[model samples]
Target: MPVIVLEASDFTSPLFLVRTLEILSSCITFSLVASLEDSELNNNPSNLHFDTFRIFCMFTWCFFFTLSLLMHILSVIQFHSLIPISWKNLTMTVAVLGALMCCAASVLFPWLIMDKTVSPRPVVAAVASCLTFLAYASESFVLCTQTHEQRGYMGSMPGLLKMFQMSGGCQMIPLVVEVIRELPSGVYMWQMWVTSVSYSVCVLMSLVTLVVIICDFAGRCLLPFDRFLAGFSLMGVLLYMVATVICFTKILQLRELGQQISHESTGLVIMETVVASITLLAYTVDLAFSIKLLCDRGHA
Candidate 1:
């Protein structure tokens, strides 16, 4: 029979505590939302839109909770050593992504269901979701405290900028989704295509690079990593610049032709424009840092 040894440190570490909190809060949030009666929902017919919000919150909480539990079990059993990827990197990636999803869900859920419903389930669920978000954010910060050398590429400033690039891109997604759901198809089709391409490419590239580094494959890359990052960041900058111009122009045109656009669609477009601008700034800085790294490596 195989021995089943437990790693006591897994239970004692601050990360362990954070993960425990994450698991508990996620469960609480999921339960509160799931427990809401159909009668409660029927109280406000307008709350039919809340089905999407409820589903989103439920999925986010369940996904994170399951991951947190699996991570904890793996740690306790010391199975992470057998995993292919860098365990630290995997943990950090989960923490960062979970924090972002939970934050977005927490913000959106309450706004969608709180005032619309008579029951207090959504309000409590929102609080639990916020706590879960905080736990994940704390986990990310804790993981980041390691020395740059120890944490590899993800600990570098440009690497962190890559995270911001991904985050800014992701923030635009909800706005785009809202716009698509609310507005008729083929309306602002060009603007939508351009914006989608810009953020999608940026997010995909950044995510791929992050995954490569996390998998410890950066050193084995065919192209020099620094040069590759420089090129990628430059591409992100150009894409975002074009997106910003097109989106802002559309916004301006809509404002001038005010009656042609609904307030809701206009608000979504404005949010997308702002997020695109911020993401562009992040990409610009990332490009600069990538260039600096390339030059520094060349000199060395």
Candidate 2:
């Protein structure tokens, strides 16, 4: 959830300056998961695990992005040894957070992708996902309020905007939906309810972040496409929230109707992938903005 938006000058390598590390890592994971789903979903009727496969892909995306991020942060240490202690500490914190998130993705994906009923405590999984999301949301809030002088170029609206977009996968919104989908028969009703609350809270924060961004733009225009993408990403988030909540509500309805699990697939689960793809594009826009900022504003 903690943001680590690297400026063009933040890295010694030209690769990271263009966001090549982030883009390539995300593409590799997305392609891998998509390939597995296409090959294994239909023919193996008894083992249709597309939902978990999607969740795995989402985790993989976050893992790789964070890994690239960590690599970039560490790479800075070798090039800028005389940088301020505060900057050094910031890099260390970012690297540590990245490593922890990667570890979480690695640990959770195996159980989530397992064929059998592996979800014993759905509340725990839901809490973990929501916590990560809230961290991202909180980070967005910080960036929205901070200025360029505070943390260099990353303190601008672009930081908030890009992070809000990235939250599509960063928050594991779809992952929570999938985890609820795969809840074992023995999963407690109260736990499910708790997870539902967590989901709603995250959606609420997403909207709130959008509101904050809009308000900031009303007073001071930051740059091109600043508020545009912020509002755009939130609209997508709102739609995803509505669709996901409806789908989740249907699952609860089926439960009350004496159905253990709903066999019918919700369109929203598929919609999540679309939303994520669009968010990825939003990130590309952010990368472009960062580059222009580096050239125009001059990186600190």
Candidate 3:
């Protein structure tokens, strides 16, 4: 039942062009990495070790490529009107979050996989990823700079905070997962378990909050949305604070325990500790914004 619109303006728009670049760059990155993976398999079948960087890069590219392609398809077919979510909000949210994830992939690919002895293929893929990230960022910048009336709620200040919170929470999920995986089975301390749970809950809440806002459920929800945001932001702050404290305390305890933990495991724990502190800071700032928004709504 969907009809094609095929507007010339749509294809020629800056956003459209940027999206094209995103798709192209993602494909190039994926192809390069795939080729490398193939070469590795053919040349060295014995290397069964996990390559987290390779898988992460491939997943990031594949996800964004598919998402961007879907958006383009929906636009050409004029399917926005039929969707329950705000099309503009959905697109802008994709742009913002895609940019963040792509940037992280770009950084991690080189840091984890590349060195002076490495081949040029991964380097090229990394460059392509960086270009893809820039393309997404360009689209985000254009959408964000548009008039408030033209842009959706996702482009606003509080909305941007939501994006940051969501992205930050997402970034932490991998770190927590890595830490938990690295920790020896049946040896994870209470601190580690509590920290992991807290991180998971915070990330889940952030994702739900973003989804509610982007779907324009803010006004229609049972509880007042601003109050919900304020309350959740406060909860996130507390959760991250506790996670950070426990993470650091565990690191110290590990030092005292000594010789029982692998250096790589300790490093993973330290990385999570640092990231938890940073996420805590982000939540604290978001809490301030949420409080201000709540107060303004109360006055209105």
Candidate 4:
């Protein structure tokens, strides 16, 4: 009698399959980015689409996919564990770090658009700036304070806030990519307005949250404003959800708008949108976990 042996490198291992799929998806995203860059996008003021949100999305997508790609490569090389719960998986870390880079890029890209002078829309400029500030605040929170799991007084508030902002900021990249790909179609539509308004509110909420965090760090008198952060963040989540639904779906309203645009780039748009939507789930989960931590803290 012979005993059948299983190894991490065996094709039967789930990790091997997942890594293979990830590599395939990464290549797909890379191909889409490459293909779209050379084509005519509605927002390309010339051949320099890099100065717009569309380019930023493609760059961020590439960066994010590359992170996963590298993780898969490392795992493949080592014949790592097949268990899905392997400690090597850093999905949350990658998501947060990617958001950090993207928010930073958003800040710089605006200045390059339109005669290389200043960002044309004040709203975009303000939202991008505010988002950057929020990302920084969240990073500081994560770096300076202990995670809730590690026994911090604030519980997972720091981590939750960081993930929410990161996720929220990231999902916007996909929407922007899609919208820019179909530019001048629904740019001034109500849904876009809703997006702008929600982001503006998010900026205010992030500012308020930052102030609270700042006071806490300074050992100053803490305000009863923690709930305010929770409230605003909750609202942001809802608003973003509604806005995303409007953008991604082929609703009666958006249907007409999309028809006006050439569908030549539809494949690339769908690819980027799918990428964005998948990443948004990470943000949602992190947000939920953070909220749960806060609740646990309160009950304690």
Which runs in model 4 stand beyond 4 Å of their true positions?
1-48, 53-99, 102-164, 170-182, 185-188, 214-226, 250-259, 263-287, 290-299
Candidates' C-alpha lDDT: 0.79, 0.45, 0.79, 0.48
* Model 1 misplaced stretches (Cα beyond 4 Å): 1-10, 35-59
In candidate 2, which residue pairs clash?
none
lDDT of 4 by residue, 201-234 (tens): 6556554554444234323435344444455556
Task: Output the lDDT of residue 11, model 3.
Answer: 84
- In Å, residue 102's CA in model 1 sits off its true spot by 1.9
Question: How do all models score by TM-score?
Answer: 0.87, 0.34, 0.87, 0.43
Error of 2 at 266 (Å): 12
Q: Please tell me which model should have the higher lDDT, number 2 or number 3.
A: 3
For model 3, how does the per-residue alpha-carbon lDDT over 97-118 read when each residue is reduced to its tens digit? 8898898788766665543214
Provide the global lDDT of candidate 3 against the true structure: 0.79
Q: How many residue pairs clash in each candidate?
A: 0, 0, 0, 0
Lowest-scoring 10 consecutive residues by lDDT in candidate 2?
Answer: 88-97
Work out how many backbone clashes candidate 2 has: 0
TM-score of structure candidate 2: 0.34
